[model samples]
Target: MAHRLLLRRFVSVTLRGSSGPVRSRSSALFPSRSSLSWHGTGPPLHHQAVPATARGFCVSHASRVTFNVQNQADFAERVINSKKPVLVDFHAEWCAPCRILGPRLEKMVAKQQGKVIMAKVDIDEHTDLAIEYKVSVVPTVIAVKAGEVVAKFVGVKTEDDLEVFIKKLTCT
Candidate 1:
């Protein structure tokens, strides 16, 4: 019981991030006074109206294995020359189909574990890659093996279809 109490105390202290004295049980259960004041009175000192960066990049989850190709060199090193089969998704931020297919494709690729990997290339950021691959359309998924493109498809595909495609790629 004492250990549990201490554990809870540590959690509360860490979560609250306040150096002041601890609050009563009833008060601690609800929102802290500072949080409520900031919410009611508008932006806090540390709060920002807009993100500092022009665009926010999605960080890969710990369990996920994905790569973002930043340039021609990165694409060559990570995708073309990769030992494992690679799925390159040529996408753009403004494209609706790309947005829809990106996450679905990622989930499908994750199921393959180490057998295959997914690489994302933003067409807007890397025009050279899109032109080199002859990718006129968004969400163009290309399967590369041994530094060569083995399979290519455009538009969104169902999870089932993607699974079938990946299985075929890995089988060979």
Candidate 2:
């Protein structure tokens, strides 16, 4: 069957080096080329030093300042127990003010450069967390430090206001 042939070809291509650069029909369908590569029938190229051009493909989460909260457990672990101050943004997808405020918060937090972190919580998806945190309105941002709520704000705030909030949070 065609499936068997395709599987064999994929396995052979993956396990052994091809004559030259091999482009599969599947890879042609996608905008980006395959990231996987093998060399000279030796071990996969992962063992070798990744080229400078390929460094962009790597993801380093340590540099990330903002992330989504998955559940109550995630909230407790990442926000409550965090060593650095965390700005928990409670929002909903359809909320217009939340949409406007989210990016501004992210930009402000990114400027902190690891001094602060932002945890985005979709109220609709995590209703329990929203209720527990007493988030009665969309675009509620709470600053938590040392497992306690330090400051909170409701609705959209200007970039200057956000910068002031971030500066105040980081200063303490």
The positional error of residue 131 in candidate 1, measured at the CA in angstroms, is 0.5
TM-score of model 2 (CA atoms):
0.70
Each prediction's TM-score versus the true structure: 0.66, 0.70
Which candidate should be chosen as best, given TM-score against the real structure? 2
| Residues 1-172, model 2: lDDT tens digits | 8796666555444534535444443442331534344335633444432221211223444348788998889999999999999999999999999999998888888877789999999999999989998999999999999999999999999999999999999998
Q: Residue by residue across 39-122, what tens digits does model 1's lDDT show?
A: 545435443222112223345551356888978999999898899999999999999999999989888888887789999999
TM-score of 1: 0.66
RMSD of each: 11.2, 9.4
Task: Evaluate all candidate structures by whole-model CA lDDT and list the values in order.
Answer: 0.80, 0.79
Clashes of each: 0, 0
Q: Which portions of model 2 miss their true places by more than 4 Å?
A: 1-17, 24-63
Identify the runs in model 1 with alpha carbons over 4 angstroms from their true place. Answer: 1-63
